[model samples]
Target chain A: METVDLKSAGFGSNKVIEWGIRTFGKIVTRLLLQADVVALTIPKYVELLRREYGAQNVLLAPHGSFEDNAVMPSFEQGAGPIKIMTFGKFGTYKRVETLIEAFAQLQAPEHKRPALELVIAGTDSPNAAGYLAQMAQRYAHVPNVRYTGYVSESDVPVIFGESSVVVFPYTSTTGSSGVLHQAGDYGKAAVLPNIGDFAEVIREEGYTGEFFQPNDVDSMAQAIARVIDNPANRKAIGMQNYRAARGLPMEEVVDWYMLHFETLLDEYANRKGKIGLAKA
Target chain B: MQIIEEITPEKLTLRLSGRFDAHETPQVRQKFTEHAPKNALIDLSGVTFLDSAALSTLVQAMKNCRERGGELTLANMPQPVRIIFELTRLDKAFNIVNAPDAP
Candidate 1:
């Protein structure tokens, strides 16, 4: 089972419902212990599972950068407005209120910078059916906020490529972030919350970015400003991230999985041979 | 890309230089496997860049060496090339020795 942090799933606020969800999660984890190997995307979870549940079969299989054909644009060439974007399923833990509010704050008359655009790309989470629509209505007065509903696979590159900085307006992280990897693949600087799995990914994956305190508009705005105010720093961070992504492409990750499966096969064959000898 | 090889009965050391990327990987893999030495050492003093495809090739070579009851050791890794191994956390998997800096 790939690791999932149930606490971040936002099951419910009710005490009884939270308790029941926790129980269900524990049962699921227990079932996972019976599997041949429980793969965890985050490195910290490998130790956590082994200590908490005494899960011996747990192994760390880190998330890989998605295969992309997006030609990395020269950061120096862009003359358009600095577009700040947050992509992926929104609402629940991945809230965008802080980001939108921060963008509104960043666009205030007092802060002097180039023209800015806020692109909230992608749809709402299943649990958050009308979250984006509600956000669009709530922040209707905020200028230049475009909600590109359901970004197509072909357009994923275009959305990421055009953006100067990618923001993660998450209340909490549920798992290893695919969006972050996408940001790295596209050579875009990230403004992320300095918490939990985000920290772990930075430490283990060598992805450097501007960090803000979760749920704080001023902090988020300041973090975004840090990247926007300086083009050299943005390009440097983006280049470092691109190099990091190039270091661990998905093909290398697949090879690691294949090798692990081969090891498991060898173990199984030995066990089968021992059982056959005992039966004879 | 340049690969200088030194082969002995027990060990094979291949010194790689230039950009060790996808373009150079096939030749490196061929040189590393041709000898099939139990113990191998990859000297990366002259390598300017190490891409993911090259990393995968090294990983395969390491696996092959281990399966033969020996180990593949990395030596004289330059800082930039070494960062790739460190960032990917592959530094912990292979036996890396900080040999004296290349002259």
Candidate 2:
């Protein structure tokens, strides 16, 4: 079997791999305690695995970030089209149906909608496929609604560069989202639900984004309309977000993980020493 | 952790201080068993912090006091302690007073 060392994977690349490895590793480790595993990416995940299924059973494997050659053109001048994008598995938490209803209301003739397009991207969860199918049928007649079932990570910059704003309609209290971080890094003005760490991240940067009550369709519609109607404000906010995101280099985030790991390892070593002394 | 029990004409007050966490639950539970009072009031004015586990203990205590034919009320909650209650939606479940010393 090919070996991987997650710790040595260059910072940005390591984190992406770690996210996946740690998430899956926990599930697999709990099922098969004696399975030999290689290259665990996340330290917290590894720590949890070790606690449940002895430290010797797992290995850390990290890989460098993939290099994609596709080039993206910079945002053009003038009031660009209001292209709103949301990518995620279709689920109750993502609240995609709420966005669809909101967009449908915007497209109503009475609203006098601006030049706007709503793109729903990402693979729909199997359980939510029926819900997604219902949305597709209901919003079939709505103008400027596009759904891309899935988009590869390499093509993300292309999507963001062509779009003016991104929306995260997630409705949850815990768990972190990589999409929120990705949108920040790409400098796309975002509209997100006010909850959990999202509130902390948005509030800290002073970015030009609005928070609406979770699951409130009318509030979401208003926030979306505000971003689409005002181009100058959108660009200003996007730029501020990009600047703020740049400060949190992936290397620094990984350094935090490394420090945590070192602390855990030292504690384990000291505990083992005490046990040995007692036995002696 | 310390629990100072005082009975007033208006309410039965228990003044709690020090850090409250999961491990301290059993001790608090034992104390409640000994000094179980009707119309109990808990003053968390001196509590530095409270976690979800501690909140569970408070909920259990409230239920115990209510079962004895009286109400359980909380008084003088600090900001951090209040936040735990708010986040867990326990604020709606408890009768919280701003100041325990107030008449």
Candidate 3:
């Protein structure tokens, strides 16, 4: 039995590559399902494997970020500007460029608008230099935006603790994101697109966050501005998110997984017993 | 966003077009802060979509206008835009007039 983090979004955009990966994945997944048990983070995929392959071996495990979930320190607003940050690897799918555009359009005189500090932190990948250069050129004139080259795993907690809000502007996805859990763990407010599991995190999980129309920079910025413009609302939302995180303690979630495993094993053994009796 | 502004000491009329969303909201916020008269009117005949962030901005704008002895009103609001207000129950907070005499 093994667990693979299948974060892929369907066949993907490239037809040739998608064809190869899907074919390979299907074959590998079928072979692996022959094993006693397989764990998946996505609920849809768990159901897919169970129904498609008729594999009772598939089981679901909730997404976990392995965070301390201690009381998160409040970010400093200083007397001048509020700090807004987006963490994780910089890639085209993450939509870092669109986030920059949204932040750029938000620039205004300090008094007329809330002063914002945008920290773009994380290692750049897949044309890192080109993307970084484009962002630097476009936001160079704006003094508030800062780019941190690479952030370590140890530093992630500190980074989440220090930001007023987290922005996840991913254009598409097949699976859930750890970033949402990471953000929620710290009780930080997020401004994200209204799609996928994110909507559930906000509406179902009862996290305090705002949703913008998918792929629209203006909608993204508007959500950000709403947070910045109303300090009280943002604070309330953050508090609510923190409370929600406390309610879904990760330790309890892990316990549930263990109990589910016990039940599955019992069911499998019982099924085998019935077959053996029939043969006898 | 094209802002057709009519400003006077008594009132401010801003005819907003295009999407009154995140990217274009700063312009509206700036003008409102600069020329938020006692009687402010936001003509939204051309707005197609309105998100929560923009809704919060409008709420703040209205509060500011009220503080300065002025009122913020929405006129010529499209059905899509009006539905948001009704859903959030902000329709009661702001004066939304569909037509000059539409009852």
Better model by DockQ: candidate 1 vs candidate 3: 1
Candidate 2 lDDT score at position A122 = 77
CA lDDT, every prediction?
Answer: 0.81, 0.63, 0.68
Model 3 off-target regions past 4 Å?
A1-14, A50-55, A72-80, A126-130, A264-280, B1-103
Per-residue lDDT tens digits of candidate 1, residues A1-280? 2344444555666769877877888898999889987777775777778788988777766577786444665565266888999999988888888898999999998888779999999999897799899999999999999999999999998898899999999877866788988888888898999988898886666687999999899999999998999888899888877765655677667876676676678779999999999999
Global fold similarity of model 3 (TM-score)? 0.62
lDDT of 1 by residue, B7-55 (tens): 8887888888898875578898788668887888889989998765677
- lDDT (tens digit, per residue) of candidate 3 on B1-103: 6778888777788888877654566788898888756778888898887654366567667767878977788889889888656444456457777662221
- In model 2, where do residues sit more than 4 Å from their true spots? A1-80, A108-113, A204-208, A275-280, B1-103
Residue pairs in steric clash, candidate 2?
A4-A61, A5-A62, A6-A61, A6-A62, A39-A59, A39-A60, A39-A61, A40-A60, A40-A61
DockQ values, each candidate: 0.14, 0.01, 0.01
Candidate 1 stretches with Cα past 4 Å from truth are A1-8, A68-70, B1-6, B13-58, B63-103
Instruction: Supply candidate 3's per-residue lDDT for B81.
Output: 85
Shift of residue A160 alpha carbon in model 1, Å: 0.4
